[model samples]
Target: MTPPRRFRAGRFLDAAAVHAAADANPRLRRFMRTVAGHGDAGEVRARRLLEHIIRHVIDDVGDLHLGNAVARLERIAVLRERIAGILDHVLEGGTLPEGVRVEALGESFDQLRTEMRELSRPRDGIVGDAPLRLAEDAAAYADSMLREFEAGGGAAGLHSEPAAAVNDAFRAMPADRQAAVRRAAALEPQALWRAVASETEGGKRAAVADLETRLGGRLTPDELSRLRTAVDDLGVARNRGLQVSQARLAEALARIVDPELRAVVAGGDVWLTQQLALHNPEALATLWRRFRDRGGRADDGPGFRAYLRHDMVTYGRGVLGEYTAAFSLSSIELFLKGPDANVKVAGTDLVGIGHDGWVWLVDDKSHRATSVGGVSALTDNLVANLRRDAADFRDAITRLQRDDPGFTPDPRILDAISRMEDAAAEIERINRRGSAATRPARISRALEERRLRLRVTSAAGEVREITQALRDLGLAVEPTGAPVPLPPTGGR
Candidate 1:
């Protein structure tokens, strides 16, 4: 028989609710009470009571013109039991018998559906209303039972379509084996994908052993290959979603004035998108306005600069919050832009060597001025920034060791690391003594030793001190002409 027609709109019941109602019926409850009263013979008495309820209470009640309702309820109860048995068997890793026909299950559902509709029809008198209400309750209970059965794979038990091959193959196995397969499939598909993607030799071996144990048998070579492919596909799909999100963020950052800043924003776009989507969606409009103002036509220079500084603080903090092991080196005000490369160097923002040979240099910046009380504030800020940069340099070395064992540090990186350490020490000494005379010279020497090129924009006044300090270090600085014009803003 075809499965019960889907209900239009009505109250639905779940398996537990249906079972509870069945057990709570007045006649069933009285029989249970009497059985328990027998003390030592309770189990035997309960079984006897159950049989009497089925034969007497249910069968005898039919003579009162409730035969259809009684019969439908009995069939529904039996079907519920069968569905439960099937689900329990599958969940336990057991398989079904080959070519099993669940047509009777479908017929039972259809009968319950029909009886429920009939019982729901309006009754003329109070006496008629009582039976009608009971029938309505039974119908609702059956609907829930049907829903639970479908969810547990009962609905797919008799499908003949090719797409249902997995279900058919599952059904053909022994009940216990079918349950094992279902349990394995249900074991967090996303987690399984990650394990397959990131597991090391030992981890992969352990994962394989665990899977085999759960499945109750060793997978054939072909089966293992197919499973791995499925997991890889899931991982690829997840990465695709991330890339799409990143692209949207990149589009948003297009109006940023500085090429170096734009690149940095792009690098962190994935993390930034997550932050905006989850916490600060309102911040997007502000960020977009800054982007739009940076288009070559606008002369909102001071406002744009202020926005950049604000973003440096807010976005920098957002990054730090997201990455537990994060440390900031320098704010954007101090970033020495590269003359030729689109990248900027500030000390270190995030440092790691990719699978590719290029070493990563990350810098975080905020608009907040470093100096508040003239030279003293400058000294304190320089010292603090140098110390943080030194720490980041050290972290980069440690990461290199972990990622590529026996990897030697590049001479340029090693020299920069040593200079950063010395700079930190000198700046700290100057800060403590409240001396301004040696501050610029010491900072200049450190910048020179690091050999960083500075990007000179048309807004040279913004970085005048930084440029002079670099010049004192004897490094040649050149402007990268006017900032490039940004494309027209696109609608989100």
Candidate 2:
């Protein structure tokens, strides 16, 4: 009886050759050194080094006779497989296999090195063209092998049961179906993951089933099971990441003192929660310092607004709802005459009357300050809103004075309107000439200044401005002071 074919460890030979080349070849040595020194969170450095070596070898092989090229391609395929095995061993903390000698494998690369050097030297034009064609064919073969290796997840993926299963399913698909799946994956990765993580088992099965159907029933029962297992693994990994992020965010919020602010943070919108959870705590702390440096005070409106602006600008709209909730204010409605009938318009993000009947209008602007275009749009919107509010306030005050005769309009309200008008004018000027020379720098500086002014004059500024206005009106007014018995938990 014929003996069963024994598995030969080609990786030992591949690893020896790579190490030997690093010592002999200046280019390869520099690459290996750079890769060794580079910092990577996991086995990424190993994977990149492996890919670079494979490409380098393919490039060096250059052109050969058809028969020689075919032989060279086969050798490269065997070498890649062995390299992957070596990577797995290294990543798993195993030393290189004993008795592997560089001299044994160095012969394999010697001919390719000679060919590469010869290609660089000027030769007969007709002869050079023939080598060039052969070189292209060899490169194509190398690329095909590389794609297959990557698709199988290199050496590390071979050990992962889920990844192995996924590869099995991927390989089972026809070439066209595989291409289609790749396209779909590229277009909507999040959607694909969501489908895999469907709440119901039936939904999950159906999604996979649909995928199989799209692939023209290419997936077998065993392959389908493997795909399901792989999907579950991916879902579990994603969920774990989200949980860790949420815990970090919760820990950060625990440091906050005010119950209202805590509530705001706790009651964050989905976008805000995701942002805060993933956001670096150290970065957040740095921003907090900047806020304090900019005259921000905790438990105050300006402080809260500054925090919101900084967080929003850095991390996007994830912190908007929670920070906006820091202010306890009433929403108001105003009536306006429309072309067809009377139209009721909602006031700004927050509106309220102080003890002395001084009205305050605040538009959070969380939406409009997230992007460059949003900044420009914000200026326009703020100007329009301020004008409308000022007109409405004037009309209402005039009506009150006519009706009571004893009613005295607060001069502070007029002053606030005037300040808003001036701010609006400045914003408009900036918007119009914002495209002049040094446009980006000018716009960026203007935006920063405006953001600072908004933080100072809006929430925090509103608190101080209203307080002073009440005192001027001969009404006893004091700050709300911090809320008592702060919640033990961050939020409800």
Model 2 over residues 1-492: C-alpha lDDT tens digits? 111223212222333234334434677545644654574422234434454445334333332233344444565667656656665765787665456455534544565455445434534322555543423466675576567556655442212213333445556656555554455455433334434434334555676566555545454665555545556544434333323345665776776654544554454432333244346545445555566577765445434444654455533332232133234332222212111111123334433334443333433322222111222222336557656665776788889999999998666566655654655566567657744554434433443343312211122211222233222222221222332222121111
**What's the lDDT of the predicted structure labeled candidate 2?**
0.43
lDDT to native, each model: 0.41, 0.43
On residues 1-492, what C-alpha lDDT tens digit does candidate 1 reach at each position?
112333211122222222233343776556655765675644223433343223222222333334444555676677677766665766686664345457754665676576556555423212454543324466565465556544644321221112232234344555545443444566533224223322233444455455555545445555555555543333333332423344555555664555544444443323343334334435544564556756722344334444544555454443432132122212222222112221232233333332322222233221133211222212324456556765766787889899999989776556555655675676466456744677556655544454432222211111222335534433331222332232222211
Among these predicted structures, which one has the highest TM-score? 1
